[model samples]
Target: MLRATSRLPAGPSGSRGHSRPGRRLRRAVVVTAVWSALVVVAAPGSADADPGLRLSNAAHLAPGVRYETFSVTASHGTAHGHLLTVDLDDARMKIELLRPGTSGAVTGIRAPVSRLADARGAVAAVNGDFFDITEVEHPGVRPTGSTVGPAVADGRPLKAAVPDGQRYGPALVPGATDEDVLGIGADGAARLDRLRLRGAVVTPSGTWELAGFNQYALPVDGIGAYTSAWGPASRARASCGTNDVRAAACGTDPYEVTVHHGRVTSASATLGEGVVPRGSVVLVGREAGARALRRLRIGDPVHVRHRLRATGSVPLAFAIGGYPVLRGGVPLDGLDETAAATRTAAGFSGQGRRLYLLALDSGAEHDDGLTLGELARLLRALGADGAVDLDGGGSSTLVTRPPGAAYSTVRNHPSGVPERPVPNGIGVISSA
Candidate 1:
């Protein structure tokens, strides 16, 4: 019932009903352009596009664990660098501190990255914390900060809490991430938090509040405790030895409380140099800290509380140092403009589901490394919801165990001739 339209044959001229060859080509071009425009308009936003991360090598070391190596050339300067990222799943891997040298010995010494990972059965690891470059007479180096701050390792308090502030920075400021705290719960959940040490000593006259703990040479004015675990070399200026020792002559005024199994055995004005009783907690203080001790009886119980609003979920925690670079997907406002060198940093995304361990290589002469701002931007580009700068420079090192291998190996070059000894390290405990 349908009839086709008729076209006249060309007789030394173009056909009346048919389109000319040049005309046909023009129509086709217009149709193609319209189709292309529609496709572009229908596409997703730039944010939904590929993040542009190109990996040279990527593999799974364990279930939910990914190791990737990538190189990036900056859009700005001739800056380019190599990066190694350890992507860990919170369900399968957990974060922990790896102290330098043997466990429970002097802690601030240099150990190979490979050795720390192997000792802890960590699949991957990175150096942690800024520490005293000043050499100690004993086996280890001192941490740069006065107090070790708040730390929990293997479900035990490693160092008691101190007030939340940089020893050299503002006082009692708690929210700064560069000097903030990090903690992990038993369920492998991780978070950034603020912490401070609070305690009180009870006496017949009144209760004297204690301010800090393990505050060895930190210039902050507060009374605190120093245990035998702090070692014999007192970094405290008022204390006896700086490099070596002689027992106190017994006229000193700092109060020493010797607590044996939760009962106060001895309280003295004389804090003599000696090994702290194996099962004792020694509360040491100066001035007001000593004043409170004068009123306490030998049998009085001492209570020290790390005042945190009972985060029942997080039973384990530790303090690591870094300036907060990114928070809530935005770079923090006022980062320093220091010259870029090798850099090491850590971040987490997807509300703590994925942990990113990053290390950038130091560049050659005339090559400017990433500044703090640049590093922050890089983390954002890599999809970090939160990020912090870790101990870098000569201290920047990353180590990983090859699949099926018994030992781990250092994968990045350290800027130091011999890698610097650090106070602590952060590692991934993949194996029990």
Candidate 2:
């Protein structure tokens, strides 16, 4: 019995039916007070941060499980690094994982709270749900919300139940609720990822490896996962309302691998009109990850990797391609020096396409633990066709765009707190 005292997040003021569970826990209010578990309030205002993060800057995060506000900073404003993870420092918060009696405790100061903890209590404690994920470069603040429940706004509920549908893959966009399995791909091979997606494309567009992928749901999709109407690769090949069954192999998405000796040619993203650098990629087509199946989506988990090279075009820009192309296109600049060794990054490849799936060292967070620089190297070395980083540290979210989870979508994991529902998810839908 760790008797810790921390300020509480006042529940909904005088609302009806304040269930027993909703009475005790904090409701994720933006309370900037000191919340501790084994201690008292330490540094206040650390929890509340401007959503739009300042690049290369440092943000002193919350009072950890104890007396510590972990420091997180960017590197010279340049998105570069290999290791990526959320720092808990010693957070102190009550965990409500299998506690049936604690359901209505914190009736959502902002939104209702969900649990995946290992403790049971009536007090307010603090701790973190740190996760290993990919941190790519985008424009501004990290994307939020992808919880699981009733509608909230741009956020998702931390809990909701899908009717358990068919087969599928990550390729849905939702606010904070509806766990959306964003069907974004990499430029290369075996690229793990951690990110929150926009509700634009069932398989939205971007580049780079989705670094850390630790969130798993029931059976994302039975066979539909591979042939689901709007799966990962389906949208890539499904030109318009038609599944490029020929190009996509099976039919749905979640990329499938038909063995022509257990291997086929990987796809490529040619340079379009732009000042793409010799190694700086500029465009990544839809069918980038369409054909490569052997090493990708089979029955278990798969990692899609990609890169941004300025080597493709004259002015240097980003283009999508695999390892075979990676080794042949750009020279090694990071760790591996041998040209042929660079080919080692290309785990699998053939004619027009190449695939690379190098095993990254998985540690406490099951992550390569890379910084931006390391990430870039991994992308190139691994043969990423195109890749983009997602929200990392603590904000990497994955959600569905809603028709609801009856469709089966899974987002990020170990979320700090669940989110309310929202509208307009940054989705990756296909006209096909």
Candidate 3:
């Protein structure tokens, strides 16, 4: 058995802080876990593993942050992973989205995880949501490089989920939707929740429902709202495909209406590109929705209101795209047990007081990666009560700044030679 320990600082009264609410405070507390090796027998659709799982090189990055690496012997071959354990109860610890630019931009360009961590001054991070990486179906259209699901940062909604059929990652586990997300709530606890887009565009003619917010694809015949958070990506991709068929031909009738300061400023038949100014919204529509937007004339009054309605009582402070893989300490049924591949995942335990970020290594060296089933099992064994799978494969990456390190460095062997540039990642910030 292997034991890893994390030390908690004392509270204002000089007593050790409690890990959860309603718990008694102690003079000191040592958080320890036993990660023993387990051997699994090969099954039809299960990962076979040797008794080699173990955590090593564990280090406390800050008062409430810890980092470690581990290796496992699997059916295909050997695999390795990097892990970050964060205690949300610590006042100096924070989790935020690590996007490309430092100007609060949510999406547009992709960058290496290390660069993103440095830009955000994060102590540790892992790759985030699946995104639109290619645009082969729509010739001449640039991929928007936007995440597949909703994004909320600093308690503000940045984007909403794309259509389930338009998602770019593997098939979601049973009962999971594109709206599923892993986020930290306003109460300072991490949990898995779903965020639905609640929005409307009211015009003199009629009020139209808004189905998307800064997403790469919109449902067929749907209208989407885009703002400055979308950066400079062209809105054309939003109208290029059908909701059920991602590769369908571009819509013949596409319309765009620009609303600034609550009034229509411009309208166009072809989608345009440029940074949307603050207090401005660009509405893109196709087919039936397009016809409705075309009726709006310049200088007409327009009212746009949108919010990401959380399914839970607690409001989310930070959230990113992902699908649930584990719940209530049990791996979800129907998870892919075979077909191992490098992956990224996040989980929470201790009633959301603790969050775990994990990224698997990929390449010729650590070739055998964890299947979705194995990934869930691994997280459960690591003490995760709930977990969500983030983007993986070439996009899988983990970066960290060890003690005395001048800058954060990529820890895992990313499948790509030069780490794959990604839309965003979950960053661990340590104020201490």
Candidate 4:
């Protein structure tokens, strides 16, 4: 799906007597070719060695860079990825996801999505999402490169694609001034808390970097009733009314979610002891009591596992300038990626491998946020070309269970279920 750019400008005939413009252009070509060759011969430019895995103990998972992102996939209640609740900056960092498909098919988001417009900025996605690149700031109330820190660490600088904007310390960019940027030291210690990047990525966030992303396909977890597939005889566990999937709580489907390992249960993130909305869960409940689902929660470590299936029929879209888009207006399908998320139905036509396994780690929601390097590595582990960041912390949930269970509870914040219900949850399910 990668596109080739226009070819080099044509040179004039008669090599030695060309005009001034032609001569300069010829020089440009020579220089460009040499530079390209150097790049080809260079080492496999890993932005940096994997973080803290090199160090004995690390406080957080960040590789010390900043960015914005959009990644969407059908995890369907399987856990091939981690949903740890760490922190970076909430108001400063945001991840959104959607499954834009109808009935049984799926779609990918592709388009020039409008951005909300902020200070310095970054954006990334999987199938794809759209937004404008206003700006991104780090650590302080005001957003500016000066308030930011260098993304480089341990002898690694920004990625090759990073344009020159400002050079604070040892930083460099297209518009980079020698006076801008903060906290980049020759000894590799960051001076500032967080550094902000001002550019934007137009494609799926994790794809270009080709790092890590998770995807999954599983049976639908029904609400209001349990499915026979997840009954007592089945190895799958069940829970309700507690943030801790393994703990017991007092509530009648009290909007609480608990995960169980065999017979014992643990941990809980109960918002309030109240029944969730009717269409907020899908956990293989009995048909008589089943309903659509609304949210998913990736609450903690210890999780449940389920086999997943996918059809590769979903489409993703981004809201650009308040309108839906596809391919950031580049054009793949008739509709744009912004619009495709909303209009897509089942049965999209593409002749590629149509299966994926997504991992989900329910809870690691500490007061902090997740990082790009951590996400990339996770996605790579999931065998994804990329992975999208969705609502997390209390807002992450996974709904899947046996076919004989009675009900599925809500365990996340924000909206309980996605706008619509699907067949499964790609969760990292586990037993107590």
Clashes of 1: 1
Which is the better candidate, 2 or 4, if ranked by TM-score?
Answer: 4
Candidate 3 global CA lDDT score? 0.81
Give lDDT per model, in order: 0.50, 0.20, 0.81, 0.19
Cα RMSD, each candidate: 23.9, 25.3, 12.2, 27.3
Candidate 2 lDDT by residue in tens digits, 274-374: 11122221112112222212123222322232222121222111111111112222322332222111011112122212222121212234322334333
C-alpha lDDT of residue 34 in model 3: 27
Best by TM-score: 3
Put down candidate 4 lDDT per residue, 290-349, tens digits, no spaces.
111112234322222221111122211111000111111111122211111111101000
Count of clashes, each model: 1, 133, 0, 166
Per-residue accuracy of model 1 over 1-432 as CA lDDT, tens digit each: 001122211122111100111111010112112111111112456422332344456656654455666544332333333343433333445677776545432232456666777888888888765443442332333333322344556765555433222222212212452235555555454555544445554444455555544544321213455554554434333222211121212113456677776667887666544445466767665544454455567787665443433234565554454556777777666664445556777776645545667776543542445666667766666656677776677777777776788987666663444555555677877542
Candidate 2 Cα RMSD after full superposition onto the native fold (Å): 25.3
**Which of 2 and 3 is the better model by lDDT?**
3
Query: TM-score-based ranking, best first?
Result: 3, 1, 4, 2
- Write down the TM-score of every candidate: 0.69, 0.19, 0.89, 0.20
